[model samples]
Target: MRHAGQRPADMPGAAGFRAAKWHTPIGTSRPSSRVLPSPARVRGPGPAARADRAQGPDRGASVTDLATMSLQQEIARDLQVSASFDAQEEIERRVAFLAGQLTSTGLRSLVLGISGGVDSLTAGRLCQLAVERVRAAGREAEFFAMRLPYGDQADEKDAQQALEFIRPDRVLTVDVKPASDAALQAALAGGTEFRDAHHQDFVHGNIKARQRMIAQYAVAGAHEGLVVGTDHAAEAVSGFFTKFGDGAADVVPLTGLTKRRVRAVAQALGAPSALVLKTPTADLETLNPGRPDEDALGVTYDDIDDFLEGKAVGEAAFEAIARRYRLTEHKRRPPIAP
Candidate 1:
């Protein structure tokens, strides 16, 4: 059988769908987003060097053959060949799929936090389409986009643009600062302060994420809705989310897609270009506004995309990505128990 990454020339795509190209998106992380910068660059073997190493001094395999095999292995292990997928068709399918999942649960509404980021915007549009599909089926459906700002968000403009584009059934802005402050106060009760000043951003950021979840669930329960999440393959592969925070959700519509692919979906779904092309940011840190996700992850999204696509990357990046995948394996799984 052909591997999933292998697409025959005659392979048929989904009805009314055709494969397309990949578009790179910027990656940024906040102190609270838990992303660290990608590993620094280091001198690594070029294609010729890798081919020589693979052939070892005795093998007769051509360098081209070795390189092709290496690329295939990498794609099999990491990348998904996202460009082979049709964005328009996938978005429609996800809309229907989410609708079906919600209908099966006897829930007719969806709730999500909109961060004005591409992931959230794309997922928000999906939610709107899902709800529309459900309603078209003669079932009652609603989509709620909640803006959970910590206080005054510098990037609130982006969030507003997304809200305008999505135009969900309802728009609610809930400042999470009060709740975050309460949680921090409770945690710090009987203690004078945290160990360090900078540590507060981390603690507060986690609080903000969890608080957003709390708000989403509350709204969902009130409206008999399922919580929607925006987690996707790129973030998942790198374990770039917080457990029980943004990670906790009733359903995720954007999983199984790389960050670049997610942007394509956003564009296909009519997401505003400004929103689709907006540099990614976590908006988790209050003091340090606009902290790029790459700065924390120590790697650029381009490299991450390349690594995921099985393209040759620097040695340091390859090792760093591998190490992160291994370390974050636990994040991708359910809690262990005997």
Candidate 2:
């Protein structure tokens, strides 16, 4: 079967979704209100170097694959992608963690952006659950779900469904297209020019991502809440997030989860099965709207999950994913010191 990276959304996507970083909307930690967001490909090297991973000098296949496999296991340990865990236990652990943060910091609320995608949908619901626990302990806490759309989102109905399930204490909608356009114009008016429309769209998409975060932070500032990010192991592995855009947040609840594992938690929380398994995308590109993230990475989410779970994927997919982890290390780290 074709993976999410190669298949259209109307068709069934990959059997598994990797929790990718916020590159686009979906790769931004498998991303908000939705599935994984993708990163803009322009800022770094384009696609994976297919030629690099070819049979390692006639070495046995297992030996040739050792480095890649080792890296995968290293990351898996870091992210805690266990071979097994009860979904309910996962939910309880995460909720307690959120509540603990609230009690310790004295923050009264948790805020998240609802993308109507599985990532955001799941995160939003978790926020609601956490805050509810805090309140039950005689503390005053609340969860606010923001709808930061860029004029219109492709999966708005799905976003609404996520809201219905989350039932957050507050819902706010802010149209980001206006602010995003203004920023793009201001950047161009500085005598900067793009080589093409694709480049222009890439810049515009990143601007939109930052703008969405700005709105979320603003709302969080106003409400005395911490911004909750949807970051998880799958997205983190790919570094698919938009650095300081979807990547910046006060709290990230979904760390160490695979895409399917995130789905498992959402299912336990009673999210509709269909929504939990919706096609994952960053949908960040205006040039190719609603594009599957797999297309951008030149591999599928299944490839990512397989790699993360220590299962073998095709050489092409394996190399592409490993290359992303190496190239995007900067995205996952702090600035260099003097």
Which candidate tops lDDT? Answer: 2
What's the residue-level lDDT of 231 in candidate 1? Answer: 68
TM-score of 1: 0.76
Root-mean-square deviation (CA) per prediction: 12.8, 8.9
- For each candidate, the alpha-carbon lDDT, in order, equals 0.63, 0.68
lDDT of 1 by residue, 1-338 (tens): 00011011112221111111111111111112233333322122321111012221212222233443353344324323454568988887788878987788888789989888898888898989889988888999999999888888777798899998888999988898999899888878957475465556555776677788889989999999888877666675555665567767777777557778889998888889988888776657566567555554545666666666656655555544555554454444444457
Q: Tell me the lDDT of model 2 at 273.
A: 81
Give candidate 1 misplaced runs (Cα > 4 Å): 1-83
lDDT of 2 by residue, 44-135 (tens): 23334121222221111331345556666766765568877788998988888888889998989888889878888888888898899999
TM-scores of all candidate predictions against the true structure: 0.76, 0.82
